[model samples]
Target: MAESAIEVLGVVRPVAQVRHMECGVVLRASDAVALTRAIGADELLLRVVQRVYLLEQRCATLSAALDALGASLRQPRAQAGAPNAAPLEPADASGVASEADAPQRAQQVVRCAAFPRTLEKRATDTLHERGFLVRPSNYDALACLVYMHGFYCVGVATKEDFGGALWEKPRTASDRAEGPSEQKRARAVHGSQQLSEDGGGAAVEAAAHNDSAATRMRQTSAPVCRAYYKLKELGSRELVAFSDCSVAIDVGASPGGWTSYLAERGCSKIIAIDPAELRQTEPPPPCVEHLRQKLQDALPGLLQRKGLAADLYCCDMNAAPSLVVELFTQAVPLLKPGAQVVLTFKNVYPKKRVWEAERDAQLDRLRSVADDVHLVQLFANTPRECTVLCRAKQSTEQ
Candidate 1:
């Protein structure tokens, strides 16, 4: 039947003798089959293309709706090429060094002032006012964040990020040890009676050197003092009077920063109390007695047995302000009538509104027991916490 169909589709062809006409019916039939198959394939492809187009349109509509709904979306944009941003070079991995002729890289020193605080806005403002730029090297940014949000001291990167850069002066081993020693000798010689007998020019020269040395010392010490003073300012202010020779109690004294400050000012004796050991592991300060116990447990007995009464009781325990205040209230009877108590309250718990309200209430309660109270908000305080300086109200004559 297939052979008959092929034969029916063919036409006569011209041979060697007999004349034959060729219609190419078989070829035409094959061409028709190919055309029909192509048509079928094209129709299938067209349907696929249409489906794809419809899917794309649907995706576009869904994307637009999401955008309108304010869903989290990221728009693609070209990356910015800032002029100041430079690519970092890989470190020299090879151990070899060229001795004959080598280019010496110049080290540039940068000076910066950082104020560590919690409020970024405030810290930025303060830095701007002080003529500092907010850059990658500036730790004041982190400090500001810390100040605004209370964080543990362990996470503080001030020493790592800001300290090294701010004070990166190269020094030799001998230079490091000898520099201060020579300074001391020079000062001693200048202040000696022997120097007094010298020529006026020598005296003048000595005075100039002394002044220069003093300036250098002041410059070197300024940053530490600045930070400390800022912290002190931020802490609540109460009348902290230092008598010529008097006893004081520094509660929650870990590193003994405050106790050392007091001792330097000629406080005869200081009872440094803390659960943690003081950082100065070598020895306690000459006048300081280290009490390795919680303040609550040791305070009452120590006061009674020793018959010791402190003129000033400074508490900087990191506990909640309310607890510190309550402790103070309990220990008040142990304190002399006219003695002054300085306590630092840190509002560490979350819910600032509730903390503030509770703090104020505690302060109000303290007023009923104490004579007169002065409450001052320290500028050094970050948003997380504040220092409260309290004094006992006793008779004016007492």
Candidate 2:
């Protein structure tokens, strides 16, 4: 039977050689003339097989690079006393050990790798064969360098990576025995090809790197709830009057997170207002009263009816600061003699300025409306935003 024409089209190289099923080189074909001339069907097939093997080898190398890069970025820094290091237990019930006996945590490892293109299943298989474990994990790009080579070289030191920790979970018995089904394998290969066609492997690697870096940042930073606790602590000492028997108004209060914090701090009552509905998994604190209306519209009427005012008005509405300032000014008259306001101003304007200048300008504007204004920029554990704590002056004549 005549051999089928195996088109060696679009591959990196045009010249191809064939190897038999038993690994013997049967023939070499550089072009059409060489392919057709004197080759029997079996020999021609062998030549195609050799070319495929070479191509697969090249692909395997590329895949290894990709995996290494990913591992480096995802791997966490090693600490000296971490589980992987020398084990030592505390002698006391408090879980505190004598300074002399404590083992220092190891420093984090840094390693990196790069791939020319997205890898297919075959590439992953090759990596496994080459002694690289399939780490079912993800990582950021910058950290990639540290993970691949760090631990192996440093032998474990004590320092946490700011990015995040790496978790290595061993595969289950079932997972080790099972391979992806044909359909899934095909889909993965197709996906890799698509990624390569659309933006190439480098772009995909870059995105994965960025995502991992961002994840690390989030993990290391304090949560919003924690930030509130920290703020309460700060206010208790530096500005004790700010929280003393205070009546507060929380704008855009949904989920009542901030409102709950204020309530816990012994605020007299909090008029929680938001256009959106509050979704509370548990009953709200007794001090909070939910009001369903926009702050700009509802605050004026609510203030007029009360005749007296809130001690602290906290605006966290996801709206423009200028508009928020206007609404706050309108509601200012309703505040008690020495009320204070805490608001967050998101920089939604087209132009950007230095952080100090922007904060100062906002404080200056507030001073114009109130008898006394004090502004403190609270560096909350959030990115791209800060808290502005303002105090209203008390009239001395009254």
Best by TM-score: 2
CA lDDT of every candidate: 0.41, 0.43
Report the lDDT tens digits of candidate 2 across residue range 1-398. Answer: 12323433222311231221112222222332223222322221222221111110111123333333333223443322222222112113332222224333333222222121122344445434433343222421121111111111111121122112221111112222243344433443232422321122222222333244434543442222323432454464465355464688887776455676677678878888986665443565667788888876786578567455778777766666666677677767667766777777766655566655665676678776665555444433233455666666575232
lDDT of 1 at 36: 25
TM-score of 1: 0.44
Question: What's the lDDT for residue 146 in model 1?
Answer: 15
Off by over 4 Å in 1: 1-239, 243-245, 395-398
Report residue 205 deviation for candidate 1 (angstroms). Answer: 36
| lDDT tens per residue, model 1, 1-398 | 12211112223222321211111121122222233233333422221111000000011122232221111001111111111112111113331122212232222111111112112234334334433343322122112111111211111113232233222222222223334444444433232212121111122223233333333533441211111332334322324556532878888777555676666668888888887766442465678888889878886578676567667777777788788787777666556666777666677767879888978887887776675566654444334555555566674232
lDDT of 2: 0.43
